[model samples]
Target: MQSTRKVTEDIRWVGCNDRRLALFENLFPIPRGVSYNSYLIMDEKVTLMDTVDASVTHQFIENLDYTLEGRSIDYLVIQHMEPDHCANIEELMRRYPNMEVVANQKTMQMIGQFFDISTEGRTVLVKEGDELNTGSHTLRFLMAPMVHWPEVMVTYDEKDKVLFSADAFGTFGALNGNIFNDEIDFEKDWLWDARRYYANIVGKYGLQVQALLKKATALDIRMICSLHGPIWRTDLSYFIDKYDKWSKYEPEDQEVAIIYGSIYGNTEQAVNALALRLAEKGVKNISVYDVSTVHVSDLIAEIFRCSHLVFACSTYNGGIYPPMENLLADMKALSVKKRTVAVMDNGTWAPSAGKQMIKMLEEMKDMTILDMQLSIKSTLKQERAEELAAFAQQIVDAM
Candidate 1:
């Protein structure tokens, strides 16, 4: 019935996991599913942090109702007004007739845009540095505009030292009954999904995230209660450092990732050759992905994780391959920069993809494209072995 976990003595994680949904935001695939976390703070006022998606309304309401024990919700704080977290606002209001919606002005406007309910008298409008005292715990609202959303704000509990991070430190996986980060092997199991989630969802707003991180540095936060993924109660710096590096567009590892767009496996063969060359040159942890087979979100996450990148593609219809072009467009859209890149192209006639890919990469900030461009006609011939060796040497030297 009520599938919930206790976050602290007063806060209960009344959230729901959606394993049936194939995609997150109908874009990225979520094989591990995702969690829509909504926390309920049991104080004298009985405040609810946020609401879950409509898809899980039944489970969410069951958990909320069981945790409330028939007590009414005095306040419903809206951290981020995104549909996934705000879908049940109207339903919540109907269930608890006197519950006041707590949010910033922009969130209030969005609430009006999304729902038909009247917020004339049943709204608590908060601003930056505003505090709400719900009996024992005091929640201080911090405005984090453009941190993925313009109206986003994070709440800090003064008593328990918990930060109700809206979506800042979130990941893309179900809780699996282990709601806390320390309960599971986070670094081994959850880091990749977390990277994918941040790189795709919040990668575009690095400056805003940096600002939020700056604000968080001043507060003595002991726990992070995000609206998705597990709660962080121990070793906070390990995750915070990751957020810091990700928000700054820094590579997580000094490694090479070779991504290829191959139509008939020709370009893929060339990528494999280059990866072998890199390995022979003492390069470790080299990652290779097929642009056509692998999801763009996964590629983007790899691009974010690796410091060095190799883009090998086969020219199609006298242009760059579709998958490779799409990946480059996504890289630009997400403001991906500050990395070293190498380009290789294969064509039966004219291999213009190498130059075109370089032009696209040049549009981004602080991208270092290697001068050793490897152009192959259909395949890597034996005569070009010397040239390939030289190209690999250039990359190793640059590293």
Candidate 2:
């Protein structure tokens, strides 16, 4: 009952897909499920790239057992210490008693913290620009300190020119038997989840990602094997360009997104009107979302994609709506910046959500808040048509 795929003549993919898990890290919803990718390189010294989560330990072991075919693992590379990727290190060590754990200094320390094992002579401590030779294939270790984790590093295979990227180009969603990017229509089905994954998980470490990309540029990489989602074996630039743009905090599309938090539907109605006005002005890439209904991770991903944003909310107890506030907190936490934003608030008594939201946005980096603010009392009445028109015009002019 082994499910495996071949990356090349010598490399085999032994990853597992989890469609039963409800959330990723118990925070973001993964309706499409997620994949825990682990690769095995067969050479003079058989090496296992990484291990999968404990939830899929049975399947992972079966895949490894079948692929190994009685040959013991010679080396276990620990690229990241996250539980999801490093859950069965002890199990793996126990299974291959003579196998050595190859990792950096920080990762070695984390091994002691996470498991009851002795790395006295069973570890190969590496640093930047270190190389490990397993027969003809040589893996060069490049330090990527905070690509998302402090102990992160990527391994480059000299023989096959495959980069064993830990999590840099990873996405959310289970692989439906299509392991390579060329096998599926990645732009049509997988881009959104990829954006969400990067925005929420690796978005905070933009500078570190940029550094990693620079290091990768020196290597002639023909394939990317991450510990999550699909492997890239063709048109590597397609995904690498995405990583470059995302790490630079640049919008992938010159689009506008209107996110609103409405209590009794008034605020949502106002957003609808604004969206139509923008459409009339020939803004074709406009998207509307109800923050109360959508997850903050989705909102953050949209915000990251769009160059312009509109936050429409209803004030509650003289403060910004809770969901809208939560979205703002996530944006700030993820280092979201370099965009234009417009604010709208509706409140029967003391309409202060607009000002409060503006205050919060001001604390972020490189955010351009439109000078025009629309304050609605209970509802946006017909008499305020001219004011609403002016507000929409301001956004159009900025765009």
Candidate 3:
């Protein structure tokens, strides 16, 4: 088992992001990969924040053993019931039958439905403003409904001033040694993953996010423990501010994300043309990322921050490119709202990428599709190339 990473004096990074995994949900490139972060807070009664993926059950057990030398877990707090975080809930129940599962009504419903993880024997339902006493520590449950998941709730620790936030304000990349926001290099360590996590995971519920933000405004949060990223100990406001911006779906700059999944060079060529036009258009922060080459998580992160998103796809299985298709599905699932988007499609005899994407965008709201999609038949010509350039110019102009 991998060594457990102790995040703070009382917290530990008991889970890891096998960065080697190429796909998330069997589809998106996790890139910096992912972490099923579980924490063991050696507080008053020794609370466990969450659990890890079932695949890493052995590692999780070992980390748990190390964390709880002689101490026993009195409370296993289930902040989110998503399989990634709650798959081991039953296993934990079996191991510690006396341990209480602290969660909300929605979480219990999900548990019973999915894993049949019954709280009949051991359950403690927390309400919107309920506090649980653990001797020296006071934990407050803040209901964050639909901020990614309906069952999602954040536990506030007044003693450590830590918010055991499940998925809120989390990032992607695996941590090196540092867990606190102040511990890592802000530019390199956290920025990319923060953007990716927010864009891909919690992009949908901007309003709920606003509500949660408003709710937390009164609390003096000193630390943030998220399910997928490192724990924030110092300068936690940095993450809060990022969540504020990302959830709003506001553009970070006049930049663009050129995403393409090309089997041949046709779609790539179109992307190249677009990139060239973007350069010619005096766009300074333009970036072209190949969906096939880069992870969708990173691509999503870029999309959330950029003002414009341009997609070029080589028709695959009669729709968007495989990687591009996965990216689109991820975007749709995240329920992205309010973004300017454009697309390009490539085909040998059948041209469906453009029309297909247009239809998909219809399912999305507040998305302004630019007036055109540059389509190429098998290959592209100077005229088609010029059309691509024109589209890029239009995107820049819109920005």
Candidate 4:
């Protein structure tokens, strides 16, 4: 049902959706929906840089047919082999018998494995710096290994100064009929999910991304056409700057992400108390997330952003609390590194929650444990609340 929307002069977004996969459309907590962005370049010869999901191949063809009435597709560039992006490649090629697939060695292997497409010497295998020219438009490929996939490559178009960046600057939510960053609330809706996606999916590929960034800076890029989400036709630097920081595993700001696990309401009160204290102390930014509520991926993103992290848990099974323990385990598995740590636990019988949390966070790299652990007995007394507030103060001061 999607159209071949023109994002730029020569660049038309022929991307389609997987609404059945997504939970909501154009909203936060993006559940089932995904966007498969395909682009058409009109030059002496035409090339389709990518294709939509197989689920929407019919609609995709309709869009392509509309966008390209009499022109024949000369090339089909396969950048990533993830099924959502490459599922329709075979169908597309079948529809355009003369279309030659341009991909890397790894991509060809994946193409053969994922579908019935025969490499059969019909592909134009490209290397790291290989270029493809369609008379007017020139495309330069950059290998991006482990930026979510090993076979992934990003294309830079010299004529339009556009980088057809496959999934590099993508996010979850579908656009609201406007395919630019300026059209949406970048700070509120997309930023966190974008960070979460990068952290969870491309977290380990910082070095590869660093290499790609260095190579890309040599070009005059005016826009970025990613395989998902909106095209970067305006203010491209914001996404690039974010990539640099996230790739470095550097904190996005001075904010603190407080993830708390509350058994009853006692531990929750302590977390709320600390959050209010942070707000009252004039520390502009803080995230007080319930481990019981927030997804672990989102938690990981916040951990990436905040220089300070706090955990509150209630005792269970004569051992560490469950939620906090799970978060810590996930963090360790992700190989997370950050600035400071704070732990608050509530244990009526054995005071093991605080001790366990402190031990786990102490093991994190480049992490300086704040010398404060608030362990509550049965309930939060007035005195304990004051102490928790002071503890929150100490964390703010340390930050």
Candidate 5:
């Protein structure tokens, strides 16, 4: 049977949700699953936006078939060539033999590299600012290279004022029959996965995202139809503001997040004490996490969300703790920046994790490492109460 939803009077959603996939891109865990959003425009010339992942190819085709209602597809617009969105390209070509593939030079090159498809006479080459007229709806393509991929571009539907934002504003999580952002409590429920998706998947491409945002400012977009998660049909600025802040490496909240790596619980003890002290200083909503237990992707997401961070780790085998080191490496690799950080290290004889963490933070952009550092020998003692109080006080003062 066909499963689909209406986005407007003429456009229909032909996407499929996958809740069985444990991981996104085989990297980040998607506990709530994900959606591969493809749209169909029912104009004089039938147009399909994109295709879903191979895992949901059958469902996607069914949705397309129902939406078409015996009308032949005229064009298949290739937005991003990432395997997840382009998995059914060859299959679709075989299904719609007369349908033309609309994409840029780079996308065409990639299609050839990924599949053995003959695009000799069935390709509609487009570039930035190029328009395709399909009766009432006119689509203007805008180049958004490196937003996630080199061949990426977004289409602007002039009539409905909808921006087909490929993966630019997409998030992880399947739409549980709720297609639009306003249909759910996005801030409370979906924002966590959304932040994680952006921080881990597209976080490294902040500069490219900023460039895309700049181009979007010129267009009069009423709805944003992304390739994942929910569509933005209302309060578009709420999501747009988040994208702007995230792309600029700005914090969404002025809160503190404490991540610690404990070998035998001593370092975790110090982290607990510090967290309590910071909370006592009137800091609410402080997050505490065991770096060894939590996924590094989740840690990266928390770091991106919080304005302040505290890394507590124990030295091991004359080096920083392995778990904490992994978290720092992932953070650096994802281009995390613009946060105030405090360091704490525990060791029986020599503590180097704090110093090593400070060095790593220095490599990132605009990171403010606190001058006050805490070192613990085996376990924190009541004798060092003054020092701990002073360290916590410094964090409070900074905030």
Candidate 6:
């Protein structure tokens, strides 16, 4: 019943994976589900890092109980107060009556806001550089506000060289027995979801993330125990580099991502032609997506990954197509920038989506809009071969 993994000799992963949840935060789609990671440190003074979602409370409890082995919890660290990670706080407090709820002022306030828990004398209020000594392991708390939440903070275990990264460096995937990042091909399998999670969930807080990264550089973090996703015990920089790049609004790849919106598939067809042209021109890793079908989160993820982007959309009611328009809004809201973008629009009579899209893109930071704006009337005709070739060449040249 106790589905747990050992992080270190004394630190046990009392986390649980949820494969049933279709959506994370009821917005972003999590087809691979997600993991709510909590850790239990068996030291002279027992400490529970955090709690999992209510969906997997039973398994989390079992894991916690089994790891504790009748030893009462001494301290419970509240890193990020998001409901997914804090759902079991009250339940945990009820179980461990003497457990000191260790958190910052904001975190303590948020705890009271979320649950009707009496923290009269059981709360251990800590600040930015506060240290919590649990025997040989000394945890130095670093306040990482708005890394995803206001009350967010990461605990660094001085003894083990491990950083208890709350929601930072986290991904949206359930751990399928392999709890460590080295156990799976993260780049091939989990990178997309990780990008999506960061882009959609924490994309808006890039500045905050950069601040946290700056703080992290000073610490010798050998292991990263995130509140979600896989534990990082090896090649920590491999992931840390990703966080650094992503938070800087920098592209992960120099490849192109073509996101299209089509009503009767005309725009899609045009996008396909362009994609083929780009591919033929030796543009590798070209991704073509129909905005109507592919989730916007996935599109955002691809946008974050690729350096070049092409938006092909059909005009609807003298405006940008709904899905494509929605995606553009999301991009602007998430502060997506520092990339080259090409616009293509299809219209039966009037083509204004391209113009409107360019207008929207202009509002963003440092976005280079391609000069060759391809305007398709009803459909892309064979006569437009030279024009399309030139357009594709521009993208190729930009690369």
Each model's lDDT comes to 0.95, 0.94, 0.80, 0.81, 0.93, 0.92
Candidate 2 has a TM-score of 0.99
TM-score of each predicted structure versus truth? 0.99, 0.99, 0.83, 0.91, 0.98, 0.98
Q: Write the per-residue lDDT of candidate 3 for residues 1-399, one digit (tens) a residue.
A: 556776667666677556666676675566677777888877768888888888778878988887788677889988888877888888888888778999888988888887855678688889998998877778899999887898899989887788888888777776665656677786576787678667766787888999999989889888788887777777777778888888787777667877887896877877887787788878876788888888667777787888788888888788777777777777788777578888788899897888888888878778899997788888778766567667777788788
lDDT of 6 by residue, 1-399 (tens): 889888999899889999999989999889899999999999999999988899999988889878888999999999999999999999988998898999999999998899987899999999999999999899999999988888899999999999999999999999999999999999899988888899998998889999999999999988999988899999998999999999999998899999899999888889889989998999998889988889999999888889999999899999999988999999999999898999999899999899999999999999999999999999999999999999999999999
- The C-alpha RMSD of each candidate to the native structure, in angstroms, is 0.7, 0.7, 3.5, 2.8, 0.9, 1.1
Q: What is candidate 4's local distance difference test score?
A: 0.81
Report the lDDT tens digits of candidate 1 across residue range 169-286. Answer: 9999998999999899999999999999999999988999999999999999999999999999999999999999998999999999999999888888888888898899999999
Those runs of model 4 whose alpha carbons end farther than 4 Å from true positions after fitting are: 23-32, 383-386
Candidate 5 overall Cα lDDT vs. reference?
0.93
**Candidate 2 backbone collisions, by pair:** none
Selected candidate, larger lDDT, 3 vs 6: 6
Candidate 1 local Cα displacement, residue 6, angstroms: 1.3
- The lDDT ranking, best first, is 1, 2, 5, 6, 4, 3
The positional error of residue 193 in candidate 2, measured at the CA in angstroms, is: 0.5
Considering only N, C-alpha and C atoms within 3 Å, which residue pairs clash in candidate 4?
Answer: 21-32, 22-31, 22-32, 22-33, 23-31, 23-32
Residue-by-residue lDDT tens digits, candidate 5, 1-399 = 988999999999999999999989898889899999999999999999999999999898889888888888999999999999999999989998899999999999999999997899999999999999999999999999988899999999999999999998899999999999999999999999889989988899999999999999999999999999999999999999999999999999999999999999988888888888888889999999998889999999999899999999999988889989998998889899999999999999998888988998899989999999999989999999889999999889888
Q: Which model, 3 or 5, shows the larger lDDT?
A: 5
Per-residue lDDT over 1-399 for candidate 2, one digit per residue giving the tens place of the 0 to 100 score: 999999999999999999999999999999999999999999999999989999999999999999999999999999999999999999999999999999999999998999998878899999999999999899999999987899999999999999999988999999999999999999999999999999999999999999999999999999999988889999999999999998889888888999999999998898898888889888897999999899999999999899999999999988999999999989999999999999999999889999999999999999999999999988889899889889999898888
lDDT of 5 at 369: 93
**Model 1, C-alpha of 44: deviation from truth (Å):** 0.8
